[model samples]
Target: MTKQQQDEPPILPEEAVADDSASIGGSSTSESQASLRSSILDYRRENGRTYHRMSDGKYAFPNDAREQERLDTVNYVWMLTLDGDFCLCPKNDISAKRVLDIGTGTGVWALDYADAHPETSVQGVDLSPIQSTYVPPNCYFEVDDLEKEWTWSTPFDFIFCRDMNGSFADWEGVIAQAYKNLEPGGYLEIQDSIWPPVCDDGTLKEDSALYKWSHLLIEACDIIGRPINQTNKRPAMMEAAGFEEIKTTRVRFPISPWPKDQKLKEVGTANQVQLVHGLEALTLGLFTRVLDWTKEEAMVMCLEVRKDLKNLKIHAYWNGYVVYGRKPLSSEDK
Candidate 1:
């Protein structure tokens, strides 16, 4: 593992410094509980899609049913990338006490983990209340933003975050908060794909719409204040947050089923499906709102990008990173 140079620290947004109030708690009477549920279900509709109303414009992706399906598909792709492992960290390190899943969209990972380890209590937190009601008894869901201060009464033994590429304005602050909210000798694992994908062969030409779309999405996310290329810099950030035994693994996720290896072909096939399903969800808002592109124009661009993604000739792939670190044990424990 090569040491990574830290990028310039991002400025914390003023809006992100609020209290870590959870949306699941604080309702006393039944009437107030019903009112809270109503407010939480009040989603913002845009361009035929729905997003979380609590932190409007905070996350770029949609939270509607279509996006939820795409998220589940993406989860499968990540699991394939990990050879069906739920996590890449040392299995022994994850305590059977408390596990926290940050940005747990749809709560699939949390629910699965809870079902697998019945002894462990799992909590999934997200800005959207789109998780299903029929979840494992040990699993819980909450609507909360992680950028704010964390107020959980107990520290987590394992904290997991995945695919939160463009979800935070202050990545460092969130990592520090995770460190603070972790039990000593706990583990924090983050799995994310590096964006603006790289191509080894010349097949992914610069003139390709796929190439242009990738870079434009990065630029749009940057203009909107949540750059998606933060995956590569997370190790250094984790190190700076006083985490020890940091480990990072980068795997190539092919754009199409063009790989000769059977394993890579399977990964590529799943990735292609999710990418095709996610193009509009990932691009529509950014293109129309941030880049000043019209709705029709954005749709056309997505169409063009779809064509490029379907072309098996383009040897395009993203570098998927799974980074994990251990919060140091206290002096007496050592």
Candidate 2:
């Protein structure tokens, strides 16, 4: 309690003392584990953008601030497309007690769902821990790979996935896993966009930059073993996974503000905004890493695509698919 003794340096813990000693000689077991964790947290920098290091080459998209803002914009675009609805699953179908959000990028949808359904306990899983720290008491996040074996012991009542078209190599496997992890009669909802958008009015020419961009993106994803054009094949996949009462809904997501309808125009405008910010983030990694293109070449291609996006003459639109299905009530039904 003396002043002299109080001012003296406090004795270090045994572990801390050992750590210091190890630092002077070599890396200890604790230090090695800490280093490995640090590497997982450390984002990888490529072509002036930062990407997730946990699943290094799995998802070819940036996880930095700019990309996060673009993702939020995409969320707004989907909201507008869905007429302000967060999901298409019927309220009566959801148990509202247990919910799982797969590939929750920023945890926005999970947080919103948890806030709206106070009784729901929501768990969002992603490869990166870039989600907001401040979350609803009923909602939390975990950093894990869904492609790996799921270790959750409890079954989820409702499992949801969105905007994950090109993020997986085996869609059927993921669907099977969801079916296995869901409670009997539980629901699984997936929302994704059809890639290589179609044009009905013949305005999207084959030589157009936007058209070329879409096809090239598809090719890149295919080469990387994660095809993005699997929206139409989801229903059959769900059915194969022993799901019943499957429902499929498609909405028009225009590329520009060229639609005559008021709501369509609004959705188009939001889509344009998202494309403006997302063009580079979406293409840079795939082009540079998968397609073996130079960074400048990729930027030029993005510039051309952006120009085409603003032309307003092309009537191109991606088909937004919202597919949901319910698990069978019993083993006999399954």
Q: What is the TM-score of each candidate against the true structure?
A: 0.90, 0.88
Q: Lowest lDDT 10-mer window, candidate 2? A: 16-25
Q: Pick the candidate with the highest TM-score.
A: 1
Q: Write the per-residue lDDT of candidate 1 for residues 25-115, one digit (tens) a residue.
A: 3344668667767877899888888888876789988999999999999898888888878898864334458999999999899888888
Clashing pairs in 2: none
Candidate 2 residue lDDT tens string, 217-330: 999999989999878899999999999999988777888777767788888899999898889999999999988999999999999999988877777788778999989888
TM-score, predicted candidate 1 vs. hidden true structure: 0.90
Error of 1 at 46 (Å): 0.7
Q: Positional deviation of 307 in candidate 2, in angstroms?
A: 0.5
Clash count of each predicted structure: 0, 0
